[model samples]
Target: MDTPTQHSERDRSSEPDTGPGERSRSSRTRARIASALSWRRVLGGAVAATVALLLFSSYVVQPFLIPSRSMEPTLRVGDRVLVNKLAYRFGAEPKRGDVVVFDGTGSFVREDLDANPLTGLVHGAAASLGLAEPADTDFVKRVVGVGGDRVVCCDARGRLSVNDVTVDEPYLYPGDTASRAPFDIVVPAGALWMMGDHRSRSRDSRDHLGSPGGGMVPVERVTGRVDWLGWPPARAGSLEGTGAFGGVRTPGGAHG
Candidate 1:
């Protein structure tokens, strides 16, 4: 009984009424998801960058804080220094006059043998601080002898000698004796004899002579060479080896 035009109108009116409302809802949901994903991606990239920087700083170059006056006039308390992690790489060993950092794991830092995990972490962090007692474990010293060199302290003139030549260490602190304790020893093969610039306050190779390794630091234990003093603007400078060593030759070898 309906007219043909009326029937057509009814059919058109029955079509689904999902207009802009449904589309807007869907678009909003999609936008929220995209924003979340973008933020996650950014955070992930930041974390990755942080990890890379830590790795490079830990293994390739390390920042060291001067904890004491042991290396004064060259390095000061609170000073931060950049150590070269690759100085002794590729068949090369530490050389005299080069300032170095080494691990005293067994040399001076005795293990608790029963410390809790937390305690161990604290100790490790303290060592990293580089500013406390027995600093023996985290030492920064100058290389006085390297493998087979005869190193003796205090000649008649109160000077230190290496391989029979009196090394004129102009870096020695004013009014400080080269060494107060008398020492005469032949550096073992693959080991080094080290000392500090501030010889008076530094307890270095001299203090470990009677210990387990005879105070000779193993070449493998050295972390790297202290190349730059980085903190305290007035004291910032490079820790260079005296070309005074250019004339000194390795034992039993022709001078290069």
Candidate 2:
């Protein structure tokens, strides 16, 4: 037997307690989503991702764009190659027939870069993204001779020979002679003699024979070895090196 006022009071007392704290909890849950989408948080995430990508591109693997026909029949213009930075990072050496990328500033280009710091940074960032051209001094070529090897162009059969052994190059472009420009030289220790598949069109170590470095690329300056073709969906495959030196003797006179 309760009065109307007493019943109303009990109803009010039994009502769910939706106070400021409950409201605050709901507001916090809603804010969590906004916080995740906040400009500052999103910007931080993007910056972290960019840094990781740059680091990976710098020291792990990098995509190099081919802008010339120097390696035609194998790599074409607009083809992108994945350069494996770890290929020679350890005690492993660059073997004959391996394709490699190196900085050619002093050896091939014969000019030092007086680059502005800001411009260099911007160019690096763009190059890492594959949006800008690699440095004008970057070069990709095949290893015709390694350290302590004698490289001679044009034997009796007009073929290039390494370590005094005639090399049968099957990867040379059609109708292209091993080399029309004759040369006889020994690769100094810790250096490499590079040539392009399209020797006729490429300005490789042969073109800088008389330069200060004797057209020799220092092993220390090698950036990485080209491992695979990355772009042009139809051309994706593991790139095989010119295996002409399998029968050639090593620098120690031991056949490898």
Candidate 3:
């Protein structure tokens, strides 16, 4: 029989030899597998984050980029406002003096729609990030009169009045009169009369008084209430109503 030590050496040599080249290839393969796994994990995390952001923006709150100078003194162009999606939900309704974001589909725009789906998607994504203006039909203005209220522009004192109660609008842009255009209309039930702080530059209820819907934005079209200014870190804060309508009575002569 072969010596014990000799037998052990022979057994070691009998095993498949793993050369430096083979070892190097094995290491590279392991490294590639590890890198792929790391990349998959990273991709999964990114996808999850995007889904969460979309859901939150769709249901909870959305950042709205101010598109024009319509709401200027109070909300400037390039400013982003935080819209509370559930503000008018359930039994609640938008009150006078509240800034709101609504789709002006039938009231302001006439069947306006994005022609290209890809462009729409890109714009929508950018809008959600507050980097681009919202859809063309989207409007942001303050609620000047709610349902069942008689809104008149340019009273004897050159001030707007709601239900005959002259509103004190301290929020109006400097030197901008309440309204140069005279209008007298009773807001229909389940509708709102919206106007911008920068009345002179804004084309609001007064502009569409003769059109269908009579410049009335339906309550259902209101997407949310603007509750906060979220852009320009130095100017970020809650956008509380100025209580311009505090003295005004609700519909049917009810005081609140």
Best model number under TM-score: 3
Q: What is the model-wide C-alpha lDDT for candidate 1?
A: 0.78
Order the numbered candidates by TM-score, best leading. 3, 2, 1
Error of 2 at 177 (Å): 1.0
TM-score of 2: 0.84
Q: lDDT for each of the candidates?
A: 0.78, 0.87, 0.88
Better of 1 and 3 by lDDT: 3
- Clash count per candidate: 0, 0, 0
lDDT tens per residue, model 3, 1-256: 7999999999999998699998999999999999999999999999999878877877778999998999978999889899999898887999988999999989988874547888888888777767688999899999998889988888777798887788879999998889998888898899999999999899888888888999999999998999999988989999967878888998656653
Per-prediction TM-score to the true structure, in the order listed = 0.78, 0.84, 0.93
Better of 1 and 2 by lDDT: 2
Residue 185 displacement (Å), model 3: 0.8
Please provide, for model 1 over 1-256, each residue's C-alpha lDDT reduced to its tens digit, 9 standing for 90 to 100: 9999999999989998768998899899999999999999999999898667656756777778777887866777777888888888878878878888887666645645676778655555444433333233577888888888888888888987777777777888787878999999998998888888899988888998898878888889898999987777776788666754555677888431
Kindly provide the TM-score of model 1 when superposed on the true structure, using C-alpha atoms. 0.78
> Mind sharing the TM-score for model 3?
0.93
